[model samples]
Target: MTPSEYEHEPIRGLPGDLPPGERILWQGGPEWRTFARSALHTRWVGLYFAAMAVLALLSGSMGGLLAAAASAAAVTGLLSLFAVLVARTTVYTITNRRVVLRVGVALQKCINLPLAVIGSAELRPLTGGHGDIVLVPNAVHRLGYAMLWPHARPLKIGRPQPMLRALPDAVNVAEVLARACGAIAPIAREDAPAIRPAALPAQGVAA
Candidate 1:
């Protein structure tokens, strides 16, 4: 869908009993990278089968080789299916008041942290040809399980915070959180708090 369509949809929930100044700033899904399968694994699988195909062609091993190829294809197909299933099992949700992550298809696992408890939010880029977001916790809490393939910012909710991975447009996600929590812009390191502009010193009093 287009960005306009996205903008039209109101931020997903009702305004609760929060103070009047509080507002629902933004809501979004994890980044597109979260949906990608490991390129290394997929490439290796393809190479192995390509070699098998070439060997079969050269040796004229028609019947037996064809059967072997079929078996290999079936196995590869199953692997692809499993990868999709895993991707679908992961989900991330961010709200003005809290962040929620859920994973697992058969048995659901969930982690939730309130924004009030968040001490800081950090964004870590996934290097080494992988693009993912890692969020660290700044305060102590049980919602410390890291989320792999997340589509949101790397946030520090409570101590031992869980890392979130695989979000799309992570930088924008981070900005939304910074504004919502009244935090300064995110920095390279997790420990540094966001810096806000200090008030100017009082001007000399007029006589």
Candidate 2:
């Protein structure tokens, strides 16, 4: 899914009340700059537009150059704004029984995934101590990637993994998740590979 699908809201971290026996283990949000760089592909997009603007100028078309400049600025600004909004609004909660994603923009959403339903998971790291955890469910559940945008794993079909996106101290978070996952599910340590930023694949379905 995409961030556009989410509505905006004021982030309040975790809810004041949680279900009984559902103890919170960890809570954090994505870094806006990192989210821009990684999820928003800000550098690549900005560079592409910058190049287009330059090309327009090189072509000696005042109108085209102006248009390109405007287009580039608009796209970059929108993406950056959204990145900031996502960073501000999102709150990832890991509880004893589930992972709760409090995300959305105009419409705030609360997604709860029971630990028992998570078949396996993977961890991908970003620069500056941030990382992501891709939770692959064993059986079919309802939600698709669209609703989990920016927080969902990039490119997987049939069963898209719900990702804990752009988390700080990702490895430690994954460790907490791993311990929790192991407690109720049958999964191998190798299944949840903790990959570094450089090691992460460049290609993805969509951010």
Q: Tell me the number of clashing residue pairs for each predicted model.
A: 13, 8
Question: Which regions of candidate 1 deviate over 4 angstroms?
Answer: 1-34, 51-68, 86-89, 114-131, 139-165, 178-191, 194-207
Residues 37-117, model 1: lDDT tens digits: 432145467678778877887888786578667866876777666556545555555555566555544444556655555
Put down candidate 2 lDDT per residue, 142-198, tens digits, no spaces.
887787787877787556778878888777787777666655544433343222233
Output the lDDT of residue 127, model 2: 94
Q: How well does candidate 2 match the true structure, expressed as C-alpha RMSD?
A: 6.9
Alpha-carbon error at 137 in model 1, in Å? 2.6
TM-score of each: 0.49, 0.78
Off by over 4 Å in 2: 1-16, 186-207
Q: Once model 2 is optimally superposed onto the true structure by TM-score, how far is the C-alpha of residue 148 displaced, in angstroms?
A: 1.9
Error in Å for residue 78 of model 1: 2.9
